[model samples]
Target: MTTLELHGLRVRRGGRDVVHGIDLTVNEGEVTALLGANGAGKSSTVLGVAGLERDTAGSVTVDGTPIRGLAPNRVRRAGVATMQEGHRVFGDISVADNLRIAALLLPSPARSGAVEEVLALFPELETLADRPAGSLSGGQQQMLALATALAARPRFLVIDEMSLGLAPLVVARLVPALRQVAESGVGVLLIEQFTQVALELATRVTVLAQGLVTLEAPASELRAHPERLTAAYRLTA
Candidate 1:
């Protein structure tokens, strides 16, 4: 049940290859964490799935269909929604309105249903529906970002950094939602900085070193064998 597949996925920016021959697969009902340092080509590889990187060379398939040159909107319509880093929501827009935009990318009937579903699932959002998105706290902003993506009813939920600039409590709050998303049959591709938190939630962990996959295994094994993973990546322990 692989919702998204990338084989030898390559992307270049500013005439330099940021991602080199990366292979990734995201399956339904599981959480896959892409663990890497700042320049490990994590963002480039994920953007290739979204069709945001134009200099992409290689293959990307969503539900077994090729999408190497497809537009981002077309990619979304094919049941993949990406929650980008930094939680970039419309600053002055109402929280509900922000969610509506994500749903508007779909068919009319699906649109309303998607909105209602997410609003009900994220009760915190319902209370702040009318508030400007910019006014929310950092934790609320991250929740709004995830809620907006969930409104798409996407088969694959591509999350980049579920916990980045938040307090410990906020990070704790997001873990359950991510688990619930996977339980509901949506594949999760998560990029996380916190190794312990990522290992706790991820079924699999893919490690990147110098823009290549240096190590990949189940999270359970990686958690139990940190020294092996670190040695594989040659990282500062």
Candidate 2:
């Protein structure tokens, strides 16, 4: 089975280390939720895995191939893509153009097909393809951001904060799309703040607190014993 592994991963920002050495893994066809409170180093961990952090250490591997220090684009080419926090999209450009730009990493002949596949994943974007991304609502922008990542056709995807500012209804709409991606055999690392949302969607869960993993277990186990999660979060608080 294919896997995305992060072993003893560390990330530093500004002048201090924000993420201590941590071990985590995302298996193919599964959603691995990296849950934590605000500033728990969840975003830092995702950045390190995506090769966006210059001050990082340890191993980031996909199927046993090391890709720790590669550039972000290189990491994507290695079948790992990150949908960063906040709905990041080209505000000035049309939605289709945003996807087209993301597909630039692929062969020219395959770019259009790649965009089409991503649109299929989020059909909500089809009618709005000609609209400016900046004009879309927060939820729409988030969908576009996710579609942009999917345009690269990654085998392993890391999404940071999929439910940042959207309403519960919007998040509800987006959740099924994510599950569809995982069902299609793409390994997913979901960094989320809402415990209930993460627990429902994840097969496995890892809790981070103060730059360290406080709990790691199957989602079913954690869901059954909610106090364990509460205790894990209280450890750093």
Model 2: CA > 4 A from native? none
lDDT of 2 by residue, 1-237 (tens): 999999999899998989988999999999999987788899999989989997999888999999998999889999999999998899999999999999998899999999999899888899999999999999999999999998978899999999999999999998999999999999999988788889989999999999999999999999999899988876773
**Worst 10-residue stretch by lDDT in candidate 2?**
228-237
Q: What is candidate 2's local distance difference test score?
A: 0.93
lDDT of 1 by residue, 66-140 (tens): 987688888888888888889789979999899999889778888988999888778898999999999999999
User: Which ten-residue region of model 1 has the weakest summed lDDT?
Assistant: 228-237
For TM-score, the strongest prediction is 2
- The TM-score, computed over Cα atoms with residue i paired to residue i, of candidate 2 is 0.96
Candidate 1 ranges beyond 4 A from true positions: 235-237
